[model samples]
Target: MWRDSFRLQIFCLLMAVLAIVVLVHNFFQLEHMDDDTISGSNWITENNVQHSLSQTTKTTRKPYCSYKQQTLSKREQAEQESLLAAILWPKPPDGKIAFVESTDPAHSDFVIVKPVRFFKVGDELEVLVRMKDFQGKPKQYGGDYLQARIHSPLLKAGATGRIVDCHNGLYKVFFTLLWPGEVKVSVSLVHPSEAIQVLLRLREERPDRVYFKSSFKSGKYSETTECNVCLPGDLPVCNFTDLYTGEPWFCYKPRKLSCASRISHAKGGYQKGLLTQEESLFFQSDVNIKRPILSSGPDSVIVKSKAFT
Candidate 1:
């Protein structure tokens, strides 16, 4: 009886050893397939797969998270490889600006306007301008100088909007309503993706690029040049006049003369004259700017202008 009992005890020990070997084998197999399995499978290692082995290592693997890291790393590697390839590639087309991502409206994938419209006086208008490539996707980087403006011819009201660069092919425009009327918001790319400041300076310095004039086609037609003439600090713009006619022009009622220098100033010192001429002209026009209908929603009051770039 004693000999039989001893033999049984030896058999039981061998079985226990076999079970441990199987568990160890399974653990190593899981580790080997971790990279591939984690990505496609939502396998939680700690609670499920690793539950049996947790007591051995006292640590659990974040398989899915590790898989995500691997994916992002691979993407970054691919981007780097593409960049290297571009550098080694032959010269591109002549007209293309080097390293510049085009902001042409034709390439725009989509644009989002926040809140769609302003409801009342002093309401803020926000626009999100997304620049896309010919492939209809947001550009990877940003170096474009964008500008936005609000105009309402019927209300004779207008305001210059602010542009915020998000550095990811997205721009934000902010505007405040001075008069409640049907308004049209216009966004344009002032400069391409490269040498933005230099290009802007060139555009501003040359009258042919961005200058506006007031002229009449009657007998002995007269013409006048207008600029946003303002001094630094909060100085009042009192001594302003029409460049050609020498007639005194008051500041736009809403005030277009910026006390501070604009971020995108032209080549030289601020062009001297009525900087707010466009907005003021809209105000002076006979068009009666009025608030939009209430029931149709404020969005009915604001309209997006056609592509201007």
Candidate 2:
């Protein structure tokens, strides 16, 4: 009779433990449920808060500007603005040049000013370049970025040449003779003036041509959202700005995941179709971009000591 009573008590103890575990499990689920509901409702509340702050921007602008450590004065602003038109990046007055009107490196050529039989170290070599268009016509304006270099592959030596733009689509490249060997000179057109205009327009108007994205994860769930130095729209974001550097990095808020769940971030890709039909003609890989100009005379000059010179 005592054994039967002992067995019954053991069974009752087991049932009580199982009931407690089930109750605790349900409580945990309820807590997580509360988090989900709070997350949704708080997001809506934050959106309203953001809207109010934007509306009061004009009134708060003065204090905002004062909060900065340094502010530029009117004279300082004028001084910097005065330097906007640099001689280095001259823009020709004639606008709306078709692709055929752009500079063609293939038709363009450079020739040694005066070919010498032998060049000695410390001697200078001067080359003249004439720019031409696709239709084989001379250009009347200058704004092309040309890169010039002199190198001796056998000696494993190289030196950059100085270029002077003559504003009438004429360029002069000068190289100082440095090594005693066969020195080859090369001049390449880095960008046409037409492409420069398109690039400048993108820099100011479409600054967000290249975009970035970040991944947010929570337990088994994950999400991806666009990110950048500055994002468009009034969407909520996770302010993961660095405390020490004070560099601000913001990612658009994920729909379901929390801000704490962000794991990795990187540049996604460039925006497509940035250029118009006419602008697209300026950037052809096979045609003008980084094409080397043909040499009208000898591309390489023989340099030596007094004996071989």
Best by TM-score: 2
Residues 1-309 of candidate 1: C-alpha lDDT, one tens digit per residue: 999999999999999999999999999976764433223122212222111111111122322122224333587779868987764322213333422233344465223354543356666777677776545556656666555677887777778977776777777778876665577666655444533433344444433333322111122221222323222233233223444433322221112223121111122233444323332222211221111111112323443333211
The lDDT values for all models are 0.44, 0.76
Work out the TM-score per prediction: 0.33, 0.69
Q: Find the candidate with the highest lDDT and give its number.
A: 2
Give the worst 10-residue stretch by lDDT in candidate 1: 49-58
lDDT of 2 by residue, 180-200 (tens): 889999999989877887888
Q: What stretches of model 1 exceed 4 Å from their correct place? A: 1-101, 109-112, 116-118, 195-309
Error of 2 at 107 (Å): 1.2
